[model samples]
Target: MPDDTAKPERKRQARGEKRIEELLDAAAEVFAERGYKAAGTNEIARRAGASPGTLYQFFQNKEAIAEALMARYVVRLRAAHGEAFDPAVAELPLEEMLDRIIDPVVAFDRANPGFYALLADPALSPELASAKKPAQKLMFQRLDQILERRAPDLPAEQRTRTAEVAVHLFRGLLPLIMTATEAELPVLVAETKEVLFSYLSPRIDLEATPQHNRRTLTPEEAARKAAHIAMRSNVTTDDVLTAIHEARAEHVRAVENVLDRDHPREDRR
Candidate 1:
């Protein structure tokens, strides 16, 4: 016998999910316009075209709403990263690469003003702060990967530092770009690209050489790549780095053993 209530229950669940999306969309606009402290639940409900009781059913408070919005955006951001950080993107000249990568971030910011508003706010709650870290970390990791591709001979430590500095510079200027007047907006954005290019070109645009044998990644670069792969698992980067080093040590010993068999041993006179 078919359960008569199954279809109605699924329809109700779908409605609830749709209603939740509406609330989050309304909260995004209100948060951008009025800020978190100023954005009230009643105003959010009004903008969503729902009653206060409807919003209360889904969210306990404004903070919960903000956290939920942030969670949604973090997912969007990871999707953006997938496109922006494609390997082919890294193969482009740095100028075109900047456009490909930076445009998505800027577009995402404009589309969801509330996310940056949360980022710019100095008084953000710890919960909301933690919710945004995945987005931040993915950006950092991808930036480092791009540098690894463009400058395969660069030391891992230096490449990591450059990636860190570039992220900070872009983030520091982002709120300015987001809040700029119409005339100033394009100028500021162009200047921002100029600044990044100026900083990156010196590092990435070294003279080509056959010395590297077609410019493949060096040992350090390969290790960095391995560590990046390991990072996707549930482990700390430090542990991954340590494991990489130990593996390298074993590889070196194996190579030495092969050399000992292939070559005559040197004797002290």
Candidate 2:
């Protein structure tokens, strides 16, 4: 007979949910202070006021901690996106619609300071990116539904293309938003709305125009008026292209600044 002293493999302890929360919170701060690659489990355990043994009881390594944090972030992100892109928002005025969309996203970003750093980092574990897929799909689905409501006659292909462009355009703004100081953030948010509104206005019906003036301009007139406004600001196609290049350069610089301040690669010094 097998020795009675032999025991089954011990299941991981599940008693310290509060302590686990504290650990994850500490991990987020460490990851924010030092990029994930540079962040250490020891520091996280110290910050959480737990012994290494205690932390190991729950998590096998730094990667496990990160995966847990990423899971929490996904839950929050999905909830925020779900609220921001509600179908009823399609009936709201353009400015209100923009506020509804922008406010929750900004709030979410402010609440999860380390999330963008982790999400954008090419060095992040594959598990994190995989976890984000469902949230991404749900976000697009909500946007697609809104688009469908706004322009029921839009061709299926056109609607899909529009949704894709909108998603990519908004996502491109995340780095700038994440890196910006609070003083600079509101302006960036406003500019994001302006850029998104411009892109989306043409694709939807004339409803996005001011209510009193909605019926006044034909699509041709509306296009010309939008162009005229840009012309008044001395903006041209070349100017637009230049701005795009500058924004891309700015985004690259911002990401580098963030990563450098946090993780400072040895050779890059």
The prediction achieving the highest TM-score against the true structure is 1
Q: Which ten residues in a row have the lowest lDDT in candidate 1?
A: 260-269
Clash count for each candidate, listed in order shown: 0, 0
Please list the Cα RMSD from the true structure of every candidate, rounded to 1 decimal place. 15.3, 10.0
Per-residue lDDT value at 171 in model 2: 59
Most accurate candidate by lDDT: 1
True-vs-predicted CA distance for residue 103, candidate 2, Å: 1.1
Instruction: Write model 1 residue lDDT over 1-269, tens digit each, in one string.
Output: 99999999999999999999999999999999988878899999999999999999999988899889988988888888888888787788777888899888887887789887776565778887787777668888999998998889999987886676566546645655677667766766675565566556656667633222333333333333333333333333343233233333543344334333432234100
Please give, for residues 151-224, the per-residue lDDT of candidate 2 as tens digits. Answer: 89899877876666556555555555666778877877776666566667767755454443333332223223
201: Cα error in model 2, Å? 0.6
Q: How much lDDT does candidate 1 score?
A: 0.70
lDDT of every predicted structure (CA atoms): 0.70, 0.66
